[model samples]
Target: MAPNDTQVSFALAEPPVETAPAPAEQLRTRFGTLTIKPAHKLEMPRGPFGFSDYTQFALADVPNQPASQFRILQSLEDTEVSFIVLPTAADNEWIGTADFEAACASYCFDPTTSGLLLIATMRRDTNGQVKATVNLKAPIVLDTANQLARQVVFTSDAYTIRHPLEL
Candidate 1:
C-alpha cells in the first residue's frame, strides 16, 4: 500500500461577470423589429400633453444624430404619430431657473431616485432658419421604476411653451 504523491491543488472557480439582460420582448412597428429592452417602453398616465388617444410609447435613440440630444417617442398604435422629445437636463443652460425640484415634488417624483424630466420638442422659424424649441410649460416626468410618464405643468408662468435653442 503506497500513498499517492501527485495530488494537484485545485482553486475555487470564479463567478462569471454579470451581463446585460435579454431583450424583454420584440416589437414590430414602423421602426422595424426592435428588440426592446424593458427600460425603453413607457406608458403615459394621461398620455402626452394634448395627445390623449395614445397611451403607450417607446423611447428610441435617433440613428446617427449629430447633437444626440433628441429621442423619438413612437406611438404604439399609430405609425405616423411620433414625437421628438428632449431631456431638459441635457443642457445645463437650457434648464431654466424654474423650480424643477418643486415640480417633481408636486408629482411625487424625486429626480434623485428614479425620474427623468423631459420636454416636447417644437420647431420654430428663426430669421429664415428653422430651429428647435422645447415646451417648458409642461414637462414630462418619467418614472424610471414604473415606466409611467406624467406631463406636469407648473402653476407659475415661469416656463414657456417655446424655449428656443440659443444657437
Candidate 2:
C-alpha cells in the first residue's frame, strides 16, 4: 500500500532516429560508364604501376575480347587509366606451364579463395596494335570475396615481364 518504495516510470522525450548509409554506386571512368555490382567490385590494396593515387577499379567485360578470359580493369579515379587483364588459369598457354599454384603460395596467396590470377596487359602502342606482351612475372590477384586485390611479383626467371602475346 506504501507507494514510497517503488519509483514510477515515465517517458516525455524521444531519441533521434539514425539513418543508414547510402549504397555504393559504380564509378564512371573516361573509358566508359561502369556498372560493377556491389559484390563484384575489386579493391586493390596497392594500386598498379605508377598508379599509387587510385585504388578502386571495376572488372568490366569487353565485347569481342582477344580471349574469353580477358576483361577490362577500369580505374575509377582517372579515365585514362585502364588495363586489359586476363586470368592465367583461363589459358595456361598464355602464361606458360609453370606451377601457377606454387607461384601464388610463394607470395603467400591462396589459390582456392583468392579469386583469379590476372596478368595485366598494355592497352596499346602508337602502332594501333595491342601490346604483344603481358606481365607474367607479376600478376594481380583479385580477392573477389572481400573485394580486395594485390599485385604479386615473382623473382623467378621462369616468367618474363613481356611475354609475347601471340593472340
Candidate 3:
C-alpha cells in the first residue's frame, strides 16, 4: 500500500469515555515530563536495533509542533532513550511504494494497517551548518491496529541508512 493509503490520524483531544479512565503515567524525557496514557503506549516484541532490552515505548507528538510530521518515540524504560521520527509519507522521494510494501511484507506487516516511521538524526557539518538525515534503510513498522511495532531493515540499495534531508 502507498503511504497515503496508510496515513493514521491522531486525535489530540480525546473524547470523554464512559468507563473508568486508564491511569496516566508520567515520565521524564529529554523533551521534559510527558504524560503517557495506556492508549499511547506501544509494545515491541523485538525492540529497535541496538536497543533490544527496551520494549515499551510511547508515541508522543512534538510539543508546540502540532502540525509537524515529526514525532517522539520515547522509550518508557529509559529517559534518555528517545528518538525523533518522521512518517514515511513525509518523504516519498527515496522510498517508493514498491520498496515500502516489500519491506513491510518481509516483516509480516500489513501494509494497509501498518504505518512506517523513519528515525531522524541531526549533526553539524564542516560548514558549521546543521544537517538532518533520516534512516530509510531501517524503519519502524507500527501495527496501529495492535499497538505493536518493530524495526525492519530493507536490503534495497535504493535506500540508505542516512539519507540527507534538504532542509
Candidate 4:
C-alpha cells in the first residue's frame, strides 16, 4: 500500500470515544430548592450588598405559578435570605445601562449568549407585603455556559434600583 493509503486506513480504524453527560447541580435553600450547574455560580468580586462576606451562591428554579415568574435564585450562608430572580425580557421594555455592557466585557462574557440578566430581592414582612428592592442599576450578569459572572452597572438613566415590578 502507498504511504497515503496507510494513513487513510489508520484514520478510519480509530473509533470515536463515548462519554456520559455531567450531572446537574442541585442546592438546598431556605426559600426553596434549586437545580443548577456547578458552572452557573457567579462569585461576586467584593461580594453582594450586605452579603459581601458571603461569596458562594446557587441559582434556584422558581416555579412560576398564577402570579409572576422567577428566572433565578441566589443562595447565601443564611439560606433564609435567598433572593428571587427575574429576567429582563424585551417585552418588559427593560433596557440595560451602558455600564452593563462594560461589566460583562470585564468578565469576557459575550452579549449574545451571555445575554441573561438576573435580579435579587428580600422580604421585610412576614406577610410578604413589605419587600425591599434589588439593585437593578447594577445587576448580576452571568454566563450560564461558562458559569462566569460579574456585577454590571448600566450608565443609562433608564434602569434604577427602584423600578417597581408593577410597571
Model 1 lDDT tens row, 1-167: 00122211211122243776455565565545444445677788678867888898777655446345566677777766677766444123433433566656676765554333445454546567657667767777765556667777766666788776533
Candidate closer to the true structure by TM-score (higher is better), 1 or 4: 1
Candidate 3 — which residues are off by over 4 angstroms? 1-18, 126-128
Off by over 4 Å in 2: 1-28, 63-68, 90-109, 115-117, 120-131
lDDT: which is higher, 1 or 3? Answer: 3
lDDT ranking, best first: 3, 1, 2, 4
Question: What does candidate 3 score in Cα RMSD to the true structure?
Answer: 4.4
Comparing candidate 3 with candidate 4, which one achieves the higher TM-score?
A: 3
- Give stretches of model 4 more than 4 Å off: 1-18, 22-26, 37-39, 63-68, 76-78, 89-92, 97-99, 120-134
Local lDDT at 73 for model 3:
91
The 0-to-1 C-alpha lDDT of every candidate, in the order given, reads 0.58, 0.58, 0.75, 0.53
Evaluated at residue 42, the lDDT of candidate 2 is 63
TM-score of each: 0.67, 0.63, 0.79, 0.61
lDDT of 2 by residue, 42-118 (tens): 66767876787879876765643423445677777777888876544412443443455665565565555553445
Give candidate 1's whole-model lDDT: 0.58
Report the C-alpha displacement of residue 156, candidate 4, in angstroms.
4.4
User: Order the candidates by TM-score, highest first — what do you get?
Assistant: 3, 1, 2, 4
Candidates 1 and 2 compared: the better one by TM-score is 1
Candidate 2: residue pairs that collide? 30-79
